[model samples]
Target chain A: MKISARNQIKGTIKSVTKGQTTSHIQLEVNGTIITASITNEAVDDLNLKPGQNAYAVIKASDVMIAVD
Target chain B: MKISARNQIKGTIKSVTKGQTTSHIQLEVNGTIITASITNEAVDDLNLKPGQNAYAVIKASDVMIAVD
Candidate 1:
């Protein structure tokens, strides 16, 4: 979905696992692991899994980038 | 905190608002909204807001990317 905000990155979906009630989706973007939780139905529709490439679409008002 | 995962995006913290119990931090990366919920304490420590660049560190098992 085209959410209102700014900060979209192309990410590779690494894996999709089942959470308690929400499904946990892991994305690999620039060698970083980006995790998001969605509904079970969403998981079924996406048909996600490991090795599958996807995007970690983030929609928040606060984005924090930490450096080493 | 350095999380064990891959998919870290360098985003700018657009805004930091108060949620029920957790603090909602909005992040802007490439014109997308990447939101994350942190504890109130974390929010206080970070002292985040708009224009502040941060990283939307996602650590999930499933990442989905949709196209038009």
Candidate 2:
């Protein structure tokens, strides 16, 4: 995926705070906090949270996931 | 804040599609698509999406907003 965000940092998942509806995803990218509020379902689906080394991929276009 | 990602670009808001729980925020950063899934209330509170020129700020650390 091609992203065009001016600030892209590589970070690790420090924590994943779960809320009723949304979850706070904390990425420790370069000693900075890059948080993304996403749905609980997505969290479960992605199996995300702390200790999972992944890319905080941000795209310039509207986010759409194609399961193919 | 200091981020440690290798990539970063500038972009504009292209569109915002509202979902039941999460909203798809489309950002046109340097002709690329950077979509962020945020809460509907955040979308309303920020009054974000389309035509609004803002920064797609991504930090390496877990994202935390300090309300001062």
Q: Report the lDDT tens digits of candidate 2 across residue range B3-23.
A: 543223355778889989888
lDDT digits (tens) for residues B1-65 of candidate 1: 67764456787778777876777777776665677767777777766667887776644333334
- Worst lDDT run of 10 residues, candidate 2 chain A, spans A59-68
Over all chains combined, what TM-score does candidate 1 have? Answer: 0.52
iRMS values in order, in angstroms?
5.1, 13.0
**Fnat per model, in the order given?**
0.42, 0.08
Q: Alpha carbon lDDT of residue B8, candidate 2?
A: 36
Off by over 4 Å in 2: A1-9, A61-68, B1-68
Best by DockQ: 1
Q: What is the lDDT of residue A61 in candidate 2?
A: 32
DockQ of 2: 0.09
Docking quality band of candidate 1, CAPRI definitions:
acceptable
Off by over 4 Å in 1: A1-68, B62-68
Worst 10 residues of 1 chain A by lDDT: A59-68
